[model samples]
Target: RVAHMVVEVPRWTNAKMEISLTEPLNPIKQDVKKGALRFVSNVFPHHGYIWNYGALPQTWEDPRHVDPDTGARGDNDPIDVIEIGERVAARGDVIKVKILGTLALIDEGETDWKLLAID
Candidate 1:
């Protein structure tokens, strides 16, 4: 899934949600606006990485101590598109929002995340 892109998450069904990228930066918030976002032939590329670490024994030394090998930080930190929750209701104003989850973006754009709930 793409790392960042404005997607509309459906309530429920079998699938998850749909997303569309806004083109043309907002110039204000320095972010892409929903208008700029498009579901056109233009497709954004996706790239990510995962740093895996091996297991160690008690022999492992803590970084805090004079010893080393504090297990070497192990985490899967990927860089991708994200949605700025701050919805826009104006034309020029730009707001800021935290990035949600990074998606493995499928055929993103003008997609729908069928709803399964009534509420």
Candidate 2:
């Protein structure tokens, strides 16, 4: 199926930006941790994110709903997408994408699904 991805953190960037879950219109904002702006650290071989990181609008991973495959409640956020297309999308760019597949990631007892897609 086709989906629209709201780009949050662009490719090859260290800033931990995300769609503001609690804000009006859910604008993209940098995530702050411990009162400081957060930056994802490179783990071993990988640098900043290798692909465009974003979420699908109008799609929420309801915390009250459990996924049958992962058997975990949702992370209470919009479904995330990893855009693997050739072009690097900019922050806040809402690009149409074709859903290729999905990865079920259980993070801290919450189901954080990563939807793999192409622009």
Candidate 3:
């Protein structure tokens, strides 16, 4: 299973903003354009995302699958992840990471799971 396999971050992620890639530190309300890394507004103060974020390979969260926790459907995307480490990776650069935990986020009545891992 893709979720059980260990892989690099950037190799599986891309410049497409929403299709795949870590959530931007600053998120614009309706900025849905893909490609290139762009900065929006900061959602937090005194703290920032300290991980090389990406997603799992070959794993899809079917929008039709019902989540037991939220009783909602999946977000129809690969599982999201945040790779915690000291090294900063450029977009499309691959890096090894260890799986840790996960954060569940509900968007527009869908469940999106964010995997937390260490480098």
Best by TM-score: 2
Candidate 3 lDDT by residue in tens digits, 8-102? 33322333333333555522122243643543333454223444555666677888889998888998777877776666665544456677787
| Residue-by-residue lDDT tens digits, candidate 2, 3-115 | 88899988888799988878898778899878999998876587788889999988899999989999999999999999998878889999999999999999999999999
Candidate 3 global CA lDDT score: 0.58
Higher TM-score: candidate 1 or 3? 3
For model 1, residues 1-119, the per-residue Cα lDDT tens digits are: 21212223211111222211233541222223474532223123422111111111112222233212222321211122223332322322222333333222222222111111110
True-vs-predicted CA distance for residue 48, candidate 2, Å: 1.5
Q: What is the lDDT of residue 66 in candidate 1?
A: 29
- C-alpha RMSD in Å of predicted model 1 compared with the true structure: 17.3
Off by over 4 Å in 2: 43-47
- lDDT for every model? 0.22, 0.91, 0.58
* Clashing residue pairs for model 3: none
How accurate locally is residue 6 in candidate 1, as Cα lDDT from 0 to 100?
27
- Segments of candidate 3 deviating more than 4 angstroms: 1-40, 43-49
